[model samples]
Target: MLHSSHEPTDYQCPFCELLNDQPFSPDNLCAPSDLIYRTPLVAAIMACDGFGNYGGHVMIIPTAHLEALYDLDEQTGSAIMWETKRVALAMKLAWNPAGTSTRQHNEPAGNQHVWHYHQHVFPRYADDELYRQLRHRVSVEDRARKALELRSALFSAEHPYRLTDTDVVR
Candidate 1:
């Protein structure tokens, strides 16, 4: 097992709670409907916070409770990268943004709020200034709607987003 650098002793991981299909916290805005793609090893959900004009960004997380990248296994990491690409492509089909970018934080100094390992996928537009913008909370309703839109693109026949049992991490 890998040691965690920043997880608190009494941490209640919001991502784990969300995966369990329960309210992660009072401030949690994620719901089952926000889940766009899920496999036994990885899942992608719509974020409840958006930066600047980009609402409904995607967060790809490992199903297990690995605290950070230092603790992630190769199998789970591969699954995440696969899902990340699929979600990014789906965002293009769903929103047609200028481009998309991915971000991840590890320790508190790195600005990681959640203890669980996760990667953020943002839809970037011209002059979006994503790094400079403050993240604002997104409504559950809007997140669910965006999840549906992205899910449609993710599962469309033109795209090979579906993961079969063979795709599972061994």
Candidate 2:
């Protein structure tokens, strides 16, 4: 659940706080993670409220804080989707779910809760309750572990998103 609002909020935007942090850390859930897989334009992090009933779930967000798809440029959008496809395949490799899906939200009216333009990628099995299950927040350690596994998969697995020869975290 992510949200976008041009209006004001009671407090502050968590994602903004994340983007502003100098040198993000993997252990800090509110900040960016070194464990996250990154392209030049986007970063994919384990969703803080990740799967309770599943594994290998993640959210891809632009490094920049754009409110919605409407605010994104073509290059950044392409990078996000490309990394998304890579992450989806990595999820398949790591978790082996029956299928996968991509989700995004806009305003509070549309079930958008976070408001920083993120895309949710999840693993789905038949008869699974990902949509119906509302209480799936994995422990922080589990999230970090799953993130490591997925990041390793992305680093090693040959994918279309690899445009140039590059090194990645192992």
Candidate 3:
């Protein structure tokens, strides 16, 4: 039987395996209150509204806990892509950004923390003031509030995608 909590031994990547073994820490993990929707492949959560002055920031993360893109199997990568599309579609429908920016970074030098592979989806407005200051100005409390708001929005039955437990396939 496949053990849900144990790291896969044949992955070939140690960092990826290490991520699987790491204990779940709330500080390292984004707040659950910020969670919008979840699936076996990924979870969508609000990234905090005041972050870049326009709000509507979302992150899509693979549930498998791979540390970086290189650690994921082809199947997992494909699933993450599909989930990302779903998130982008939901963001566009709900927040209506003038444009959207998707970003991914790896390692400390790359400004990545938490050691998990994730993609950032930002809803951008044309004249947002905080655009240039995003790297330095996002606040945790604001992010938490945004996350809660997003969670409330996504949980509504009228939301486009009805995410369920079965959506998360191993």
Candidate 4:
């Protein structure tokens, strides 16, 4: 269970502090429900509304949180990029959109709320106005259900390896 947020901590960053304070839970360690892909070093999961505007809002985050891209070691950086490509491919396959955009925001000025460095994958479609409007109106329960549905679709036997990384550039 997540710890009480009322307790004050000396840690400077909220994300770092949460990581330090909470007892590690395997479920928490697992990707969020909207997760569509995973690799040994990185995982792609959907972001909550606080993170973005899209319904299929995905984020590729290193299994180990690194505060900033500059803070990432060379190996981790490469791994993140590899995982990102896999995610983009999965998004394209699932949404079949006209295009896709990948983005990363760091620090306060960059509008990063999680503190951990993560890349965003937004799927775009030619006629997606309905999706845009629905994304905004979705309730938390509806989002949770959709996330579960996405997870099942991505991980089913037919697509067992769809999200698995391939020949990541070392």
Top TM-score model: 1
RMSD values for the candidates in order, in angstroms, are 2.9, 4.5, 7.4, 8.1
- Candidate 4 residue 94 Cα shift, in angstroms, is 1.3
Model 4, 1-170: lDDT tens per residue? 22223222433443233223544343232223344445556656666542234455667777675766766788888988876665565555565667877778666676665557788776776555533434443345545565565555454455534432352211
What stretches of model 3 exceed 4 Å from their correct place? Answer: 1-29, 48-50, 129-133, 136-170
Q: Give per-residue CA lDDT, model 3, range 1-170, as digits (tens).
A: 22122223533432223224444343343443455666656666655334445655777777666777667788778877776766666566566677777778776676665456778887777776544655433466766666665554454466676455566432
Q: Write the per-residue lDDT of candidate 2 for residues 112-149, one digit (tens) a residue.
A: 77657889888788866778756565666777788887
Clash count list over all predictions: 0, 4, 3, 0
Residue pairs in clash, model 1: none
* Model 1 Cα lDDT, one tens digit per residue, 44-129: 88998988766779999999999888987899999899899998988888899999999999888888888888899998999677
Clashing pairs in 2: 2-113, 3-114, 3-115, 4-115
Better of 3 and 4 by lDDT: 3
State which candidate has the highest lDDT: 1
- Scored by lDDT, model 1 comes in at 0.83
Cα deviation of 166, candidate 1, in Å: 8.6
When 2 and 4 are scored with lDDT, the better candidate is 2
Off by over 4 Å in 1: 1-3, 160-170
TM-score per candidate: 0.89, 0.79, 0.65, 0.62
How far does residue 57 in candidate 1 sit from its true spot (Å)?
Answer: 0.5
Angstrom error of the Cα, residue 24, model 3: value is 7.3
For candidate 2, which ten residues in a row score worst on lDDT? 161-170
Task: Give candidate 4's whole-model lDDT.
Answer: 0.55
Once superposed on the true structure, which residue ranges of model 2 sit more than 4 Å away at CA? 1-4, 7-11, 19-35, 158-170
